[model samples]
Target: MKVTVELSSLNKDDDKIFGNIYFEENEYAFPEKGWNDFVIIILNWWAKSILKLLKNISIEEELDFMDGPASVKVQYLKNNSFSLYFILNKEVVYSSEVDVELFTKAFLKELNSLIRNIKENRWESEEIYSLMENYKMLQKCFIP
Candidate 1:
């Protein structure tokens, strides 16, 4: 399937950093960051995870985004195949074309591991705790 992830203006310009994933159709686009702030940092971590995931899946494609934070739309083939687009920095905006059940299972597993690691390490500094609380609050806007 052709999956494309477009970056917004908030992200930067990188001619050589395009098409870093395994997608059929390819294009250039911009991204934007919505309500939640510190999008860049959040996406930085998210991008790393995506890169690692894609490697594990043996998908070859390109990924491009501005140096800052931005929003994105992840699209794919198969007549509206599963895809995900969301603001990583802002409460994790997500759009998906994958199977909901499977995705949920995998996502929850990974998230649980991440949360457990954070808790075990006691990495929640005052500032980080503040951000985590804010993120939790932002999640309420969608989860409920």
Candidate 2:
């Protein structure tokens, strides 16, 4: 039960992001083919939802992929476990069960990677700054 993310491309001019989310062997691509979207909003939502899950204050969360018309829904199960569903066009495309601890660790690692990527690319924008801040907050609040 591992989760990882790769932020492959960032369109600074449009503030659109392209990325892949890997849940073990499954890969979910953002902005789904032939479409592009402003992904920062959903990334921020995901980070905040993770915070709530870690704090045990929320049982479920659904995040839309903006113009992509895609989403990932998370349902918290007992004892640090969760069910994850990837939906495209309001249809469930993929689903998996994961351990939150492992997912968080991988998510944090990906966030660090993304931060480095942003700095190396010298992409500066208010939206990127806000996303980084959200990631920082999540890292700070995560216990493991």
Candidate 3:
């Protein structure tokens, strides 16, 4: 509802995004049976999935993603219609308030990208930062 990011990278499989996790955020929960089912599929398959796609979309849950020693927390903000944040360590590294409909669609698209990147062994590359910077332009459209 507030900000977003559109990313581009060399790989066809990547959305190249690095901020504001849409799927984890309650603020952008525009419910649809089809979409919910689709997310469940992705969660069931991704290498390091952060969601379980349970019924009712649990916003109070604190989800964390871990791969060996690395960890990232996906938080649920109760204020401002329940925004979601990605906290790295004790710092809030990424925060996004997305358009409910657009972000959901985008998140689905990006999930595939993430899977592809992970498969290609490039999920944590520098392109993520580039894409994050590129995505900052998204705020301009929504902030006004």
Candidate 4:
């Protein structure tokens, strides 16, 4: 499976993110208990870790998450009077904020850090991205 993230928004400071994960083989073929399940099961954990980083910066925020067939929203209120919203699911994932002044710098910094961590730890063990690569290659083989 291969997952790619795309960002779109009204401005460069606060934007929306969209993520799509493609599978090469049968959906049930994923090593993480087959393809019928989504990679989100693994990613959700990472999401929690990502939120922890903002613990000191944000407060009084509500994390409304729905582990259903729909989406999940994680909201964080920063000390600078800014709020960050992370809408994520198996098909789409994005982060944005309401306060420009508060989230502009912090949001970008946190996002960059999150991406870096994913890239670094992904190759260490049976990580989610590795499974995506396997799925992508497996699916590519069928293209011919």
Candidate 5:
């Protein structure tokens, strides 16, 4: 399965960022219509969760997109594999098995792109800075 993440439409004024996750044909978009989700909080949580997974410190992790009413629950399987359950409004929207290495690659790629976009747009904020710190930690510890 192909998994990828996209982040865009950073509204500095309202402190919201719009984004979507694509797992092959499955798509999960956040906030639906308004500026309700905080970009930094979501991204930081994701980065930290991924870090824990990489370190084999957590067998399961659940990421909740605050105010978006969406979440992703990741459960580790044997031999660098995981089960990903995408939830929307307390229901499972999609679920699939994913290779940990591939998922990490996709996540890191999108994260790099997000950092570049932030720099290019000059959209600096405290929240953004905190997220960057978390990203840095993730990068330092990531193996592949």
Candidate 6:
């Protein structure tokens, strides 16, 4: 399974970024806030558990939109070589790679934790709380 994360248009677009995380065919595209929003949500929701997964990951870039690189990327080269390419404003910025197994483990762990909290209505923020409420309401719909 390939896990590709793409980030684009961060600096110039009102300092906002957009991104998509794909697990082979499965995709969890973040909202307009991009990966930063996802990170913020994870940190705000459960930092103590997922922060350790960052140990093996490293992203080095200018992060300056005006006088520096326009994008950033991260990928996993070892093992399965799950790659993440970050393009800023349709321009290539940087690339980061990491192990898919480790990243997926952490991702699923956090996702499970998040869903558990949502189901339990233990969100500390209104954003997530509302999200969970909507999710609960969505549960009533029968999907074929």
Give Cα-based local distance difference scores for all models: 0.37, 0.69, 0.35, 0.34, 0.70, 0.37
Span of 10 residues, lowest total lDDT, candidate 4: 7-16
lDDT of 1 at 34: 29
RMSD over all Cα atoms, model 6? 14.1
lDDT of 1: 0.37
Assess candidate 4 and give its TM-score to the true structure.
Answer: 0.22
Error of 6 at 54 (Å): 21
Stretches of candidate 1 exceeding 4 Å from the true structure? 1-81, 85-96, 126-144
- TM-score winner between candidates 2 and 5: 5
User: Candidate 1's residue-wise lDDT over 87-137, tens digit each?
Assistant: 445543444456433433343333344335446645444433543544343
Candidate 1 vs 3: which has more TM-score: 3
In model 3, which regions exceed 4 Å deviation? Answer: 1-54, 68-82, 112-144
Cα lDDT for residue 76, model 3? 34
Off by over 4 Å in 6: 1-78, 122-144
Error of 6 at 129 (Å): 15
Model 2 lDDT per residue over 68-143, tens place? 4667788999877878887778888878788887787777787778778878988777777888997887777754
Best by lDDT: 5
> What would the per-residue lDDT of candidate 4 be over residues 6-55, giving only the tens digit for each residue?
21211111122123222122342111221122333334343343244344
Considering lDDT, which of the candidate structures 2 and 5 is the better prediction for this target?
5
lDDT at 9, model 6: 18
Total clashes for model 4: 6
Better of 3 and 6 by lDDT: 6
User: For candidate 3, what is the TM-score?
Assistant: 0.32
Which tens-of-lDDT digit does each residue in 9-127 have in candidate 6?
11212322222333332343312223333422322232222222233434221222222233324443446544555565666533445565565455444444455644454334454
